[model samples]
Target: MTTHVQLHDRLDYQSVAPLMAELTAIADDMLVIDAGNVRHLGTLPLQVLLSAVRTRAAQGKITRLAHASDNCIDMLGLFGFTPETLTQPEAWT
Candidate 1:
């Protein structure tokens, strides 16, 4: 099963370490990112996660993103991610 990492607001150098630790421990074939709660992210965190995305892709792994808010998507766009990265967004009823 794929593991979904739910990152809270303030995704910086500190938060990424724990996330990395979690990623390292998981042996799932897929990775899903839930962006519903993210508020702020620093360059380091962005770099770290982006590198992971690239690396995982190189290894033929799956990394899917979902539930990204508009502000979060905008920030990701500033860092080179387009709207296409969001694959399966959930609509709140």
Candidate 2:
């Protein structure tokens, strides 16, 4: 089952351990992590996202992020995450 992750709070530079865990559960399915309303972005969030995506990808399943903010894009680049709109693009802002 594909799950849509809509984010509205601080995603960057914040500990997403709790969020990560929740996302992990749907790792086996198509996941959409929405960050359209996010304002702050940081490396930690990027790390968590990458890690989660990688983990899910390895299982033949993948995670996707959408509606990312500019800050999200910067963080993705800063963390070396390539251009994947749903994964690291600021479509929302």
Candidate 2: worst 10 consecutive residues by lDDT? 84-93
Candidate 2 Cα deviation (angstroms), residue 72: 1.5
Alpha-carbon shift of residue 1 in model 1 (angstroms)? 1.9
Best by lDDT: 1
Candidate 2 Cα RMSD (Å): 5.5
- RMSD per candidate (Å) reads 6.5, 5.5
Local accuracy of candidate 2 as per-residue lDDT tens digits, 1-93: 878877756764445776677776773468877877666666666667666766677677756767777766666566565438435333313
Model 1 Cα displacement at 57 (Å)? 1.3
lDDT of 2 at 68: 73
What would the per-residue lDDT of candidate 1 be over residues 1-91, giving only the tens digit for each residue? 8898887777878887887776666567798888878778678777667667766776777777778777778788786664355332221
TM-score of 1: 0.78
Error of 1 at 52 (Å): 1.4
- Per-candidate TM-scores read 0.78, 0.72
Clashes of each: 0, 3
